[model samples]
Target: MKRWIILDRDGTIIKDKNYLHDPNGAELTEGAADGLRMLAGMGYSFVVLTNQSGIGRGYFTEDEMNAVHLRVDEMLACSGVRVSGWFHCPHRPDEGCSCRKPELGLVRRAQEELGFSDADVAFVMGDKKSDLEMAEALGAPSVLLMTGYGAEEYAKGARGTLNCGNLRDAAKAIAEFEDGAARASFSRDLREHAEVVSAMRSLEAQAGAAASVIISSLRGGGRLFVCGNGGSAADAQHIAAELSGRYLAEREPLDAAALSCNSSALTAIGNDYGFDKIFSRQLEAHGRAGDALLAISTSGNSANVLEAVRAAKKMGIRTIALTGGDGGALAREAGLCVCVPSSATPRIQEMHILFGHALCGIVEKTLCR
Candidate 1:
């Protein structure tokens, strides 16, 4: 399923200014552009729903508002992001407009134009009570950021809502959550099929074994290699980065490298040998005995990742595969396969990160202790 996100503006997008409407003076809060760009890169289509009652009160002209939005788009584009749409409710409390906050009309308008019903969005992110209530009404998850009115919202016990320090943190959480849901949902039907479920269970057991191997290797002064393609490639690098350094925690850096981080090597190898050889070649060149290679593939069938794992095994490197669906062909060829029980690519990818983080946490605690 496609993942869409509804983001609030004013307090959420730009810094809240107590009903101020000078678009010329509007500026995005810290990390807002980065947050939006990160979500866009994760395949999320964004729609901005804001209560701009300042417009209804003649504080800012519609033309001025458009100019301000254009500025926001420009900033995002500079960071390689594009907003799908923007919706604002230009009515005051006195006017009692349905499109205003505490009402779902603005979101409804966005749903109509974007062709994604309320059910399609994974989460709504904002710093206000109306934002959470709107998300609840639509049955979508909500992330409350501690920016703008977020502190107040948090103080009011926004317990069920995912809480973050800022928009960037909130966006990251939503992205992770959506990916996990995809992985879980994909494996739902297979749970009823005894054979597949048994195989998956076996795979999970193997993952525990592999985790032990990884811990032992690191304790003995070993490193890790990770690789993939496109989004999976990003995941490969992300996981490696987290383990090598830390994920929201401070600690000594571990020895890890994501072969996918080298763009020059990828292109040169792809041009000379082939895309399938990019990872395997790197593995042959860099992998050593006792090192671990983590291979991530949504379909569990990326030729490059598979080839890389093969090379790692041949080179005496321990291997772990993070895959989705029926474990695909990679399941059979791995030392251990963490097959997230989800067919949905998004969800599987999400779980892969969590698994990576969890693995990192365990490794850090066990070794550094």
Candidate 2:
């Protein structure tokens, strides 16, 4: 489904220059470009709906208004952001045009042109009451930013709108909301699956098996190497940090490194040998016989992660894989494969972190004693 972010141009995206028509006068509000980029990453397309009354009042030409929009687009493009649509209501307040703020003409046009019918899923964002009114008319949620005339609007009792400090904050809030919704859906689905329950029952046994190898490796004075990609990359670093520092007890730091943490080495190896070789090369340099490699992958089939696992095996390092969905190839290759039952990425990741924390806690208790 195509979700739209309907934005008010002057105060929401750029500094409000009273009736801004000159391209040179257009300046992106701080973090505006980044905010739009964040929304773009979340699959929301932007449509700027602005009220350009200056053109209607004969204060500026329609051409001048277009030039300003061009400037805005150019600025946003520098950050790899693009505005999917540009709409304007160029009529005076007294003209009684239906396309003006608080009216649904522009939104209707957008719906007809863009081929989207669901208004409830769309978001309207601006710094004025009229924008909120428009959203209400369309049955869409609205976000009011405290940017240009926002303070005055708030003082005038602009209620029933989500208020934000800036566009960046609004973007982050929306992303979080989306993620929460996804997790909720995943949780509901997981409850109906008997396999997830079965998987939970096996966690203790799996953790014990993996913990035994990890504890023996550390006791033998060998280090731990961890690697993954995307969300798993973050999990890799997080687990490595917990092990190298203290997990739940105050104790001496253990030797652990997340191969995915070094951007310089990652880029150098990727550029020189290819993306699949990045983790493998890092493992070759840091991994040794008797050490342990903790490989995290939601699918358990990422080329880079698999390569690292193979490298660890070749180096005589014990390999542990945290994976999901039948555990892919890593389950067969690794010395210990702990597979989360759910196939959904978010659910798998949640289980991966939980498993990591448990293992870290067990290791901490053993080593500290």
- What lDDT does candidate 2 reach at residue 19? 84
Which stretches of candidate 2 lie above 4 Å from their native place? 1-199
Clashing residue pairs in all predictions, respectively, total: 7, 0
Q: List, residue by residue over 1-369, the lDDT tens digit for candidate 2.
A: 788889999889999989887899999987798889999988898888989889888999989999999999999999999997798999999999999989989888877777776553468999999999988888888998888888789889995357887889888888887788899988887774545656667678899988888898999999988889998899989999999977878889998888888889999999999999999998898778999999999998999999999999999999999999899999988988999978877678878888888889888888889
Best of the candidates, lDDT: 2
What is the clash count of model 1? 7
Minimum summed lDDT over a 10-residue window in model 2 is located at 192-201
Clash pairs detected, candidate 1 = 179-347, 182-347, 183-347, 183-348, 186-343, 187-341, 187-342
lDDT per residue as tens, model 1, 207-255: 5666687787777788888888888888888878887877656778888
After superposition on all CA atoms, how large is the RMSD of candidate 1? 14.1
